[model samples]
Target: MNDTSTTPEAGAAGSVRPTLAAVARLAGVSNSTASLAFSGTGPVSDATRERVLSAAKELNYAGPDPRARSLRRGRSGIVGVVMEERVGDAFRDPIKIALLDGISDEIAVIDAGLLILTDAGEAAQRIEDAPMDAVVLIGCSPRLDESVAMLRQRGIPLVAIEGDPADDVLTIAQDNREATRVAAQHLADLGHTDVSVVTLSLTRDRARGPLTDERLAAGSSNTTLERLSGVRDVFPDAGGYVTRGSFVEEGRIAGHALLDDPDDRPTAIIAQSDLLAAGVIRAAEEVGLAVPADLSVVGFDGVRVDGLWPYDLTTLVQPAIDKGRAAGVAIVEMLEGGVAHPATFTSVFHLGNTTAAPRAH
Candidate 1:
């Protein structure tokens, strides 16, 4: 008989998978000691740790199964990130991408995986039933009160970005009202009395049309409402067109409608998003109007637009990544049995070439 034939093959298809118990037995240690050596949560002697690792290698034991560890800790080690819009649509925005990057960076440290859930199609049910340790709701609407209630019932730690869904949830709020107010006032100082606005969606229905008094009263999105109010603070009667989303095409549609009437066209336009601003710019060019010379346009959210050179967009530079990181830190604190407080971030005005005094006819 060959001695090599008698030796157990490590990780062979037919070989039995080694367990922590077998590793501990080979290392002459208790099961608890082996667990501590792997988890690093409890103290273990250096010599013992080395012995356990050496034994685990010989036995082909890959420490403990993550599933079993999660079960033992009573946590799934997964964080659910819920968005109000479809994942595909949400990903198109640079702000959303930067926010997600910040969130992923913070959560990676705790060995928690992210499970993205959107409140659309069949995935909406996951908002209430997902096996996650905590959840972060990004750009959620006040209309999601029922969903928030369900998540709360399930005992999931909740953090909301820029929405007031509930009083108990840790909120990472933005200074939407003040920032837009400042932007509007900038145009006002430049003698732009005939200014119009291009707004984001006001309701879940995403009805695109003029922002009527009735529609403004029934607005469900906190961000849209806040920014709208900010514009109203400067231009009380500044009428605007509501869009389905913060999309360029929607802004272009709004721009054409607002600019079609040359006699009644606004001297300036305040777009709620940078993408919308870019569309408004394109619409101006389509009508043979030069930016800042014939029409002055201002936008919010200082996101870099590809192919938008020769025009530095004058917008409010909000701390998008920092907002996401704040939310992530809040989630970590809550999950670690610590209290987390709500955070509010403000935006800085970035002066660029897109804005100037309205051209005299």
Candidate 2:
């Protein structure tokens, strides 16, 4: 048998990959001219471009190396999207999908790619070492302040979507407190005093149980704390269940725990997310309780839930996509040596059939 893979001039790979310099030499042009021909960023004659392309094809060269171009530009052409949860968990929410769509739309203008990083799980290492020109923190928690500090020290432009306000970070904030307050007040006006809440994970531990004073104090998520505060503002001492994530299953568990109590049951339940509200409605049905009549359910984030029809969930319609766009624009401005002012957006109240006055007992 004859072993055939090695060449005298080539390393173990059989044939050394051609470089731009080799292509330039073969094309009889300067390295810079060859680069400009391929990049189209500078003035290059049609004849020069053709020569470079021919040379590249002959040597099986794939134009300029992205690593070298990134080195020359001193940028990775990557924008990091930092999430507090796993990427899979984030993608499960419709609101997050819309937000990502908006972010992608704006970043495409600059020919930048997104790098999704999570503070938890295996993706956590990337949060500290990834080469990103800028980073957008979505639903950041206080525990990640160290990560933010490190990113700031590295001079990476930072933007936050509903994150805790920092000194230099540009934030795209939402009216979580005000929106929930309005939703709660709507329930208040419906002649229902016994109202409960199904909250998003208050802390990173994600302990699923009733909300206690210690748990409330230990809550790290800014959005959850703000929304919970809003609910308390209306129904002081109104207790509720804390969920593990923003999933419908968590909502169903909470709904069962809250509604199954024979001694005391809330006439209305305020879910932190629309999906949670839908789950709460499902749980209501499982217990033979009709929505709006036996129980009124209200949700935040105007997301369309499948199988949630005929119950146009009463919710605070938030501009999730606009918020993402604002964050992307802020990132671009910061990268270009411009200041991006912190922006706060309000949610509109959408009256839906999911909520109604509690039935007379």
Full-model lDDT for every candidate? 0.82, 0.82
Error of 1 at 102 (Å): 1.1
What C-alpha lDDT, on a 0 to 100 scale, does residue 141 get in candidate 2?
80
How well does candidate 2 match the true structure, expressed as C-alpha RMSD?
12.9
TM-score of 2: 0.81
RMSD of each: 12.2, 12.9
Name the weakest run of 10 consecutive residues (lDDT summed) in model 1: 2-11
Worst 10 residues of 2 by lDDT: 3-12
Per-model TM values vs. the true structure: 0.81, 0.81
Residue 126, candidate 1: alpha-carbon lDDT: 76
Which residue pairs in candidate 2 collide?
Answer: none
